[model samples]
Target: MSARTLGRARGPLKGSVSVPGDKSVGHRALLLGTLAEGTLSVRGLSAGQDVASTRRCLEAMGARFEDAPGHLRVLGVGLRGLKAPKAPLDCANSGTTMRLLMGVLSGQDFPATLAGDESLSRRPMERVAAPLRLMGSSIATTDGKPPVRVAGGTPLKGIRYALPVASAQVKSAVLLAGLYAQGETAVEDPFGTRDHTERMLAFLGHPGPLRSDKALTVPGDPSSAAFFAAAAALVPGSRLTLTRVLLNEGRLGFFTALKEMGARVSWERGGVHARETVGDVVVEHGPLKPLRLAASRVPGLVDEVPLLAVLCAFAEGESRLEGLAELRHKESDRLEGTAASLRALGAEARVEGEALVVVGPARWRGGRVETRGDHRIAMAFAVAALGGAGPVELSDAACAAVSYPSFFSDLEAAGA
Candidate 1:
């Protein structure tokens, strides 16, 4: 148990921080770059271990890479050129690497097993497997979890799948498999999950002109930016600036929640990169209203739920987050972990059916936060501790390296 005790903030946090590149976009860009038949120069790839797992897996399958400051160059192996990996793909803690590559491996001519850490091995993988099977790919999960095995030479035929739930990973898996299918593979995503995969595919000329620029710049991650924003919102008189964050509509649920909670959240659209919108976001402290989150918005809000739950821990009303059953399958059972984190922060919180209801104006009387080895939860608790009345001891502070390696240091520099 790697622990860190965060002292209470004595003053409002004020600073500008550039978060790491968007992890979702970074994963898609690297994967698509592997399929493109030219040198793909990528700027600002995510430095987290999850994206590192993706890059390592791609390399094991014969993609070569060149490295330089703030840039990574992928020598394309082309769509049909990936060789059989020399060993089982070790995905570590990245569910994204295992899940998305399950789609990519399904269409390959060699057998592969997508394995991950114990945490990831327990996550549901059948959501991706069932659809890949429909497309004639042979996939077997360990009772609907990881160690997902993909058999070789299973010729694919694309089928339009209507998602039983809104999951961007599942959608991307099926679509990536669609690339090798005999017919058009289409996924009807009515819930509007982040389309980073679709956009990257289009930008890489999947069904359009193949003349895309070889260089791709990834936007800064919005999910990482949310923690500082939440801290600034909770700490009175605070102002924090986050530069070059991804501004996709699907990724803006946290911002919407922030706005409804009365934080002065503002942004300016700056430019576009790899078919993603980039912008600078500023968050300021204000009187917070309790968040009344609807169930329909769950898909877009999935990653931000914990951070929002932290905000709800201090907001001035009863905050109810519905349709969070998906939270149970993450690195931890976050639905319960979130309620627990709120309670630890001195708020009344519970799970009533599929909804998590938090009643706040939290007293910030902090104690030990149980992270359950999940990086996002660890980071959220760091924010909770930043605005706390007492120091918080996190159970797994080192887990933040899975995504945001510099999180604690950045928190300090940005006014912890």
Candidate 2:
């Protein structure tokens, strides 16, 4: 594992930075492009390892990609055009690739096995497998985990599924399977999750209400912008503007929580990108106030909880983050990882039931943070180091390349 030491901010993080394209969007774009009948042009695609994993897997299945300076032109072979791969499809550390691809492969006429790295292999694949099975896809798994084997040539039928949890991946998986089913398939989540897949499908002229008012152009990732927002909020006099970020309502819970915590966060409507909302976010350092986060909002900002925990460590008084049981199934046991990271940074944090309670305004004496090969955990702690009492050393710091390859360098450029 690679390690890096992060020092306290030399000055307020001040600058306008362009984060990479949305990872969720990038993944869906590539997958949908493969099923598209014509050449699909994708602008500002994420250049992360996770998206690369999706691209590699698709190429193995016969999709061709034409590269451009900052975009890609994918010549799709249409739905049902994917050929069976001779070898198992390795999704690497990307659960999105494995889960969503399961849906696509279910409708194929040839068998395919989806495998992943150790961390991803440990994540529950049965959530996706069980649903595809309902659609008549024969899938076998290693105790509900990775190495998911899908037996192709099985006919599929559409069924309405109410998600037990709000999972964009599972929902998208089912919907993708629906495309090849005999009838319409619908997924209903009690709490809405990121709808990138739905939006992209509609944009590509797939039949459904998932269509948008404008053409599809993927916006910058809000999750990536959260790290910079946290840095700006923690460092005095820090002001940062993030450009062309996805401002989808279902994905703004973290920013909402931050605003409630007294962070000076604001946004202006930029325009639409890829049928998704795009905007400019301005985050400035300010006095943070402690607040309670409802459990219901967890699904919307699930990916940002670790970053929020870092902010909570710096805020005055106790901050309770509820309804985070889903964190247990992520790249790591993020609930435990977040608490452990905070404790290592000299803050009071612990998991109580399904929630994480952090007693804060504690001195942030930075120390070693174990990332457990989770990219978000690595990046969150890196943000925490910006205002720490000492240098924070992150083990497996290179794991940030999974999502944001330029994270550390961009952080340094932001003066943190």
How do all models score by TM-score? 0.98, 0.97
lDDT of 1 by residue, 259-372 (tens): 889999999999887788999999999988998888899887798898888888777778899999999999999999988877876778899989999887777777888899
| Angstrom error at residue 176, model 1 | 0.6
lDDT of 1 at 238: 96
Give the poorly placed runs of model 1, Cα more than 4 Å off. 208-213
Task: Give the Cα-based TM-score of candidate 2 against the true structure.
Answer: 0.97
- Measured by lDDT, the strongest candidate is 2
Instruction: Please provide, for model 2 over 235-350, each residue's C-alpha lDDT reduced to its tens digit, 9 standing for 90 to 100.
Output: 99999999889998887888888888888999998777657889999999888877688898898899999999888888889999999999999999999999998998899999
Question: What lDDT does candidate 2 reach at residue 297?
Answer: 88
